[model samples]
Target chain A: MRGAGNRYVFWAVALAAALAAPLALTNNYQLGVAHQALIFALLATGYNLLLGFTGLVSFGHIALFAIGAYASAILVVTFGAPFLVGVGAAAIIAGLVGVVIAMPALRIKGHYLTLLTLALGEVIRLLIRSMESLTHGSQGFSGIPRPEIFGMSFRAGVPLYYLLLFALVLGVAFVWRIEATRYGRAFKAVRDSEIGAEVCGVRTDHVKVLAFGVSAVFAGVAGSLYAHTMRFISPEFFSLGLTITLLAMVLIGGRGTVIGPIVGAILLISLPEWLRFVKDYYLILFGLAIWLCAIALPDGLAGAAARLLQARNSVRGRASLRT
Target chain B: MVELLSVRDVGKTFGGLKALDGVSFGLAKGEVLGLVGPNGSGKSTMINVLSGVYRPDGGDVRLDGRSLVGAKPSAIAAAGLSRTFQNLQIFGGLSVRENVLVGRDCRLRSGMLGGVFGLGGSLREEREAKSLAADLLEKVGLARFVDAPPSMLSYGQRRLLEVARALAADPKVLMLDEPCAGQSQAEADALAVLIRALAKTGIAVIVIEHNMRFVMNLVDRIVALNFGRKIAEGTPEAIRGDEAVIEAYLGRRGHAERR
Candidate 1:
């Protein structure tokens, strides 16, 4: 917490491991799963900006993600827009919607905001299902191509996985660098106490809107990535259950830290595959894990790990002082 | 003397309970005013109104001749008024320095995009805010605890931390609500010295204290309130002997204990 050099080394090692992941994946299916993990990692990292830093419990987040996916699919499949343009448009569209969602936040507080967001999310999903001409209704949107940037095709799983990894890396770096900035501090202050932040000259209304907008942009990009990689997206996939999973990824992994959601995303995404032996009951195990984590690691795995690391460092420092 | 803050006939009602009824006062630059009142006499409500925590149902609050009646607490802070709560509201998730940096957030011109890119302008601004945080913490004698969390600080030390954070906004007017509450005598004396030094720098301060000894010695003027009305306003000596003030205190069960 005191700006240790070890923190940088820790992240550097994590980055190196991420770079080498596809090499160890061995098969296209495994690499495809890695791609999903990276996309969700990006999504959860953005969600952390709101849930972990801003202290907003908005259930409408996945609705933004759904919008991003559908927007990209429509632009690419129907209108013949380039993949990059689709992604950019998706982010902008979702970000605008996010700001609209944040408007209700200015007048509401606590459980009221949460309930309003829940209602709003459900409405968006219902709308997506009803809009048959654009979204293909509940039947789903399919056949979206993988990214083709600057004439370089990423049709292969290995190449697509690297593309996704690149995005997640960029996102994690942004969150990391932003933490030292004044806006980042403002975000945390609002989380701690809205009135306190307001009293200290922080324009909390702008901060909330910013948090929502920025995080929604992330959701949009991740949704675009998810649509392209999976080559399919349906209104059903963007349900309240998906929102709960996203929340679990941030909460059980660590809410506030940059590395927390990535860890959570990777763990949650792969845990089901790893628990194939349990078959259908894997969900029960997953539920129990989340419940136990809520009770045992209130700060999440990253927070607990940071505490352990800090304690060890202090212990060593004291030992060295005696010598 | 030019009044930095003027509260004129301000009133607030909570479910037919008139918390502040026509309360009026003016604070001059560099003067420390003590707001003394028995419980439920609207002391907190007065602070809340001036700081924009509540909208006055009647009357107006002006800072530097600008109407601030319906402005948000954040806007009021940007207009050069900052405050600390009676109950500590420090950010537990942030380091001591970051907590103070948040106070200067309005003045910093960095956006989320600038922050994400580690852009040169925002980086420079971030460094400037860091040093500002450091300077404020050192001024409040919390330099050693800059990187530590506020949760680690003692209750008295946390009070000083809050003061440092409030000052980080560089406000021309400050409101401290029960700053000496739960503090030891030595800690309270240290705070008194800090407050006097702050007032000397031309910042008008409103100190709401029930500690008669601290209030009598520290403030340039005293305003006594009873039943949401200003019963007395004058020098500390005058208010100490004012018949209405004596009765206002005597009627309360904690009068002898406070005095």
Candidate 2:
């Protein structure tokens, strides 16, 4: 935390492992799981901007994901548009909707805001389920083609894994970069104390809105990627359960830190597989993880790690002084 | 008298209680104005109104002839008015330097896209902001804690951090709501010196403090409030002897005894 070198090394090692992951996977099934994990990581990272950085608790974020998925699916399957156009439209549509969601959020605080967003999310989900012609009714959009961009195809699991990996890298890098900028500070300012931020000239409304829009854009891109990779999507998949999972990812991983959501996503996504012995008992584990996180890691895993890092650094400093 | 900031008939009500009645005052550039009163006398309400935290229920506030009555707190801050909270409002998650940088944010021109990409100009803006934050922290005697979180600082240090953060904005008019609340005598003296130095730089200052000794010696003039109404406004010496001012601080019994 003191210098950039250690942080760079951690990223370098992580990146190297991610780039090498596709080759190490035994089968396409594992790669598919990796794909979902990476996509969730990106979505949760963007959502972190609102939850962890800006102190917003939004239950309708999954609705934005639904919008992105549906927007891309409708465009690509029905309109005969290219894959890139579909993803682009998804990002734009979700980002716009995110801004809309932020408007109501501006005036409300705590539980009321959460309730409003929850209702809004349900309405969006219902709209998707009812839009029979566009969303194929409750049967869900299927037969969606794999990603093809610039004459290159990501049809195979490995290539798709690489593509997804690239997206997550870009997404994480963007959050990391923004954390050093003024906007990042503004977001945190709103989270810490809205009145204080306002007094200091930080436009809390704009910050919150920007946070929602940007996070929705992340959900959009993640949704589009999920659609193309899975080749199927249903309104139910982007419902309340997934929203809870996304929240768990950000909260359990580290709410505000760049790598928190990524770690949370990876761990939670794979936790079910690791718990195959218990079959459906993984939900219990998920609940347990969240409960433990709340009591033990109020700042999440990243904050815990940072504390350890600081302690170690202090110890090393004292040792050096003695030497 | 210089008319740098003009407050005209400003009023605020919370429920049935009038927190501030029709109160008016003028602040001149480079003048140190002290607002002293009994605990509930609307001194804080006045600062809150001017800083845009609360929109005045009636009348207007003009900064250099531009009405800021209904402007957002941020807009007023952008227009170069800044203040600290009486109850400390430190950003616990941010380092001390970053907290000050938040104050300088209004003056920054970097866009979200450019900032995310780490564009050259955005980087430069960040560097400049950091340097400014560092400079302000040094002035407020918290240079060593620039990278530490505000929570790590003492109560007095946190207060100083708030001032440093407010000053980082390069405000034309700065208001401090109880800046010396938890400060040691030495720290209070240091802050008084800082206030005088800030006034010398021609930035109009309004300080709300109950420390009469500190206020009397440091401020060029004083305004006393009782029950949200301006009871007296004059030079510090004049305010010191004003019966209304004495009654406001110590009740009618003290005023009668003085008489």
**Candidate with best DockQ:** 2
Model 1: per-residue lDDT, tens digit, A213-311? 999999999999999999999999999999999999999999999989999999999998899999999989989989999899998999899888879
The estimated TM-scores of all candidates read 0.97, 0.98
**Per-residue alpha-carbon lDDT of candidate 2 for residues A50-97, written as tens digits (9 for 90 to 100):** 999999999999999889988998899999899999999999999999
Instruction: Give me the iRMSD of candidate 1, please.
Output: 0.9
- Lowest-lDDT window of 10 residues in candidate 1 chain A? A1-10
lDDT of 2: 0.92
Model 2 alpha-carbon miss at residue B236, Å:
1.4
User: Candidate 2 chain B — worst ten consecutive residues by lDDT sum?
Assistant: B249-258
